[model samples]
Target: MKKIIVLFSLALLSFSAQAQEIKWMSFSEAIAAQKKVAKPIFMDVYTDWCGPCKMLDRNTFSDPGVVSHINQNYYAVKFNAEGTEEINFNGKKFTNPNFDPNRKGRNAMHEFTGFLRVPGYPSMIVIDEKGSVKKTMVGYKTPEQLRADI
Candidate 1:
């Protein structure tokens, strides 16, 4: 079982590496690259405790077709809304000072959670090439569903 899990993870990683190189860029990199690119942006808002987020990573985002489409049409940014990382966007800094580092789970909501206005886990915010919100989605989504959205 352990071997299977490891193999599965490795396979997913390899597929992710090949299927779509455009994914989860650092804040600064995303901002810089996206400014010059003509495609839209898909911001994946998630928390470690959210089961659906992991599922999306394992299933939906890993799909070769979905990955290809996203890579061609969007810049994917994985945002751990409850993470500890400090981020700056559009000349504004964002962080969560009250986030409990010692806590056991992914409950540390980032300051941008409120700013982006997403109210749920595994939320996907689609931004146009002009950096405007095109759509917002919460919970799990299949590759087919994502295709439909695009």
Candidate 2:
């Protein structure tokens, strides 16, 4: 009985100590959430085939400080630059009409990505509560650097 209790306590402690992840929302969801709570949007624009984008997710974004800071201060959003999902931003509906499903690597950029004029993958776009772009950081950023930028 004592052994079972110890194992249960250990499992509970491990679960409580697990890493926290950012509560990522879609662009439209972030916009809607802004109306209710009025938080700036921290949009991560990435592509599936981008190496640096994956690195950002694994190294910087997974950091506890980065995750906490973003969740508390901003409405964290993850946008796929080459995805087919239609997004409505700035009173305009955007889509990747030219997206090739058969393509394995890089597909056509989403219309919203073009509208934002994103320089490349792993672009971190900060949008004000009013839905306007505040800052755009293009490239991989460490937790310290990202914390400083936001």
Candidate 3:
């Protein structure tokens, strides 16, 4: 009986260790998906050069609980704050007109990033099913903090 109990516990531990990943899509995709099935959108706005952003990706987002909760509850989207991707939102096309390909470290901020008015790196923008901005969380957050806030 003790051996059976140990096996069961180990199985449960392995199950919990198998982390689910957040299905991160583009902003446009997330918006389109809302029409089919209304779900809150969670956007992670990060810059390539941001240290905290990388830390958040490694520590918080990789957490099994965070990944599972985000996948099940929100339409997760990842938008690079300084990326060159052109995005269409609310009938307006936003682009990074000032982006320099030759630049080394930091590039120009994307138009949509400025439009969102993100205060700093690693901002998590939560939009409602109707595409209205709900909350903007700035800075790095732990898994527990993210779960509580979202």
Rank ordering of all candidates by TM-score, starting from the highest: 2, 3, 1
All candidates: CA RMSD (Å) = 6.8, 1.8, 2.9
Which tens-of-lDDT digit does each residue in 100-147 have in candidate 3?
999999999999998999999999999998768999999999999999
Best by TM-score: 2
Query: Could you tell which candidate, 1 or 3, scores higher by lDDT?
Result: 3
73-144 in candidate 2: lDDT tens per residue?
A: 999999999998889877789999999999999999899998999998899999999878999999999999
Q: Where is model 2 poorest over a 10-residue stretch in terms of lDDT?
A: 12-21
Q: Estimate each model's TM-score.
A: 0.80, 0.91, 0.88
For candidate 3, the 10 contiguous residues with the lowest summed lDDT are 14-23
lDDT of 2 at 15: 76
Worst lDDT run of 10 residues, candidate 1, spans 19-28
C-alpha lDDT score of every prediction, in listed order = 0.81, 0.93, 0.92
**Residue-level lDDT tens digits of model 1 in 12-49:** 99886776644567555666787786677788999888
What's the residue-level lDDT of 64 in candidate 1?
A: 78
Query: Distance (Å) between predicted and true CA of 8, model 1?
Result: 21
Q: After superposition, how far is residue 45 of candidate 1 from its true place, in Å?
A: 0.7
